[model samples]
Target: MISTDNFTIDSTKSKAAAAERFINLRQQKKVKEFLVKQRGYKRPDFNRMILDLSRLKWTHEKIAFVLPVAGASTVSELARGGIPNFEHGEALIELWKSETRVDRVPREGEWQTYKYEIGQLELL
Candidate 1:
């Protein structure tokens, strides 16, 4: 590609990068839309997982660990009536289910207990 000036322009790299970004954004949009629409639709598996975690006394921080890609912020948001990305919600539900099935106290709870070692980790 060339501009009004005599200088030549390489648009191939820029175009590819832009296209990739567009696709990612498109996917995110779709996920968000699906989640919003499913608000009324009941997901028995996901609902059961939430109830089980609550009964087990799992904190939001602990629950957030299930959402590796989504993180704690999204978990908090959902608690406060905020929408989250679909992929994050799905990952969180699935992991929570599996972890509960293999529940091990004093043994598996090692990860559940010492999961968040809060100290010099955060920057102020």
Candidate 2:
């Protein structure tokens, strides 16, 4: 007679087994089919748009009026299309470095701003 009590799996082995099970789940027919379908999609040229958008710097109050004027209808567009070019941004950085502006450093929150419309802003 086989004694189940004598045979026990260690915790590490059980964890590894669980991980293998999870990986196998990802390879199931439905998931495989879905991933194959998704791979057929054509992603847009976000890089070019991001390069074009990255040229502007705007204050919080200006974003509401600036975005539409800058030709970007959405916030994500600005995030991807970094302010046209970094030249003016570099200038501002330099000016800020010289202590000419009290608030000059570009912070994390600054990048998400959807301020400036196309006509209202110029790309450097």
Candidate 3:
């Protein structure tokens, strides 16, 4: 006959097991995959875009300000090669495009100033 008198459940062990199970379930559901499937930018492209924006003097804070879904930390991560979700990626690209444009043509006054500066440099 089996003895059941000494058998007891360990609450700590059961709790640990439950936690492990939860973690495993979470790991199996990769949200990044879903985001990618929904047209998120790849890591490389995202990183390149971030770098380009940085070259134009766009700081992490500045980017985060423009992207509704991102904070400074998120912007920093994205700048350091992290991939952005579809919406954020598209917004970043649009921000880059807007910043890259010359808002207006340089007038004659601006051209004359530039020409004078160049002439002064040539005299050196």
Candidate 4:
């Protein structure tokens, strides 16, 4: 009887392990599909990126502070349609991607309201 009980317990354990493995494999497949979809997305050009950032209420000085570029003047020049060096261009692209996640950007007048709400939350 004891041997039978042990066998049943071992069988249950094996089933649970198999189920966990299946779940993990499914999750990995889903992640791969998500990555494939993301890869199909084309990044915006530097000019459009600068324009979008401006629409989001970002100033050239603020962008310069975050970027590895020379200064605010460099950012302003880029905004005016000057091409950036490879390094600066990559940095701007990265910044644009990080800041422009889906549904996180605010409409024209909503940015200040969102900022105020964030500030209020931080006060706590």
Candidate 5:
């Protein structure tokens, strides 16, 4: 007979199981599969858009007006990382093109934000 009391919980295995479950739950909440397939984006591209728009003094209010994907509360978060929603990226692309009079998105190579790092220099 198998005894239930004889088994010991392995913490590493337990943590791994928990992480897998959490990932599954998160995946369920992701944007629609077909939509994501059609309009997904790379992280760096979104980051560049946020930075450029911010420098151009485009407010969250303006962005949200065009697409509900960007909200005021998430402006800093999106700027620091990215707006995950494809709709927001599309709207921002339009805004950038019209305001900057440029009809292009940053390419993988052109997404290089900074040439040199201030942190590399020794502190005075």
Candidate 6:
């Protein structure tokens, strides 16, 4: 149960630092992709954990180095409709807690399956 709200600019920056610890995992030849689940639970208490996987999709086009592909698609759809969307960012935070791996590439419409965060962007 990680709350995206708790991750301030500083915490997000920290996560960026922690991201370095995972670069090697992605560089491995056997690793087709990799995903780092950095999440937190704050309602009852603060519980944080990081899951390092061997494969993931680097969706740098939509969000940061890591995020949900489906969530990205949803935002793209919303943006096409001329509405602001940030669902993928929230899903990334929640996925960090519950999801342990990125075994397969996310297909379209998958993000709607989860009620989580969206894009991480400053409104223009």
Cα lDDT of candidate 2 equals 0.44
For residues 14-103, could you state the per-residue lDDT of candidate 3 as single tens digits? 889999999987876777567768673323345545655676677878888988754889988876667677888778777765765422
Which digits, one per residue and each the tens of the lDDT, describe model 5 over residues 1-124?
2337867667788789999999997787675675677575534355566556656677776666665563665655666664456766677677766655555566344554434222233111
Instruction: Give per-residue lDDT, candidate 2, residue 124.
Output: 26
Candidate 3 accuracy as TM-score: 0.43
Worst 10 residues of 1 by lDDT: 115-124
Tell me how many clashing residue pairs each candidate has.
0, 27, 0, 0, 0, 14
Please rank every candidate by lDDT, starting with the best.
4, 3, 5, 1, 2, 6
Residue 75, candidate 3: Cα error in Å is 1.0
Candidate 1 structure quality by residue, lDDT tens digits, 70-123: 465656666554544677666755666465553422221132333321222311
Instruction: Name the regions of candidate 4 deviating beyond 4 angstroms.
Output: 1-44, 102-124
Per-model lDDT: 0.56, 0.44, 0.61, 0.69, 0.60, 0.36
Model 5 global lDDT (CA atoms, 0 to 1):
0.60
The lDDT of model 6 is 0.36
TM-score, predicted candidate 6 vs. hidden true structure: 0.17
Q: Which stretches of candidate 1 lie over 4 Å from their true place?
A: 1-40, 43-48, 69-71, 100-124
RMSD of 4: 11.9
* Clash count in backbone of candidate 5: 0
Q: Give each model a TM-score.
A: 0.36, 0.22, 0.43, 0.45, 0.45, 0.17
Per-residue lDDT tens digits of candidate 6, residues 26-50?
Answer: 5763354332321321121111111
RMSD, every candidate, angstroms? 15.6, 14.5, 15.5, 11.9, 13.8, 24.2
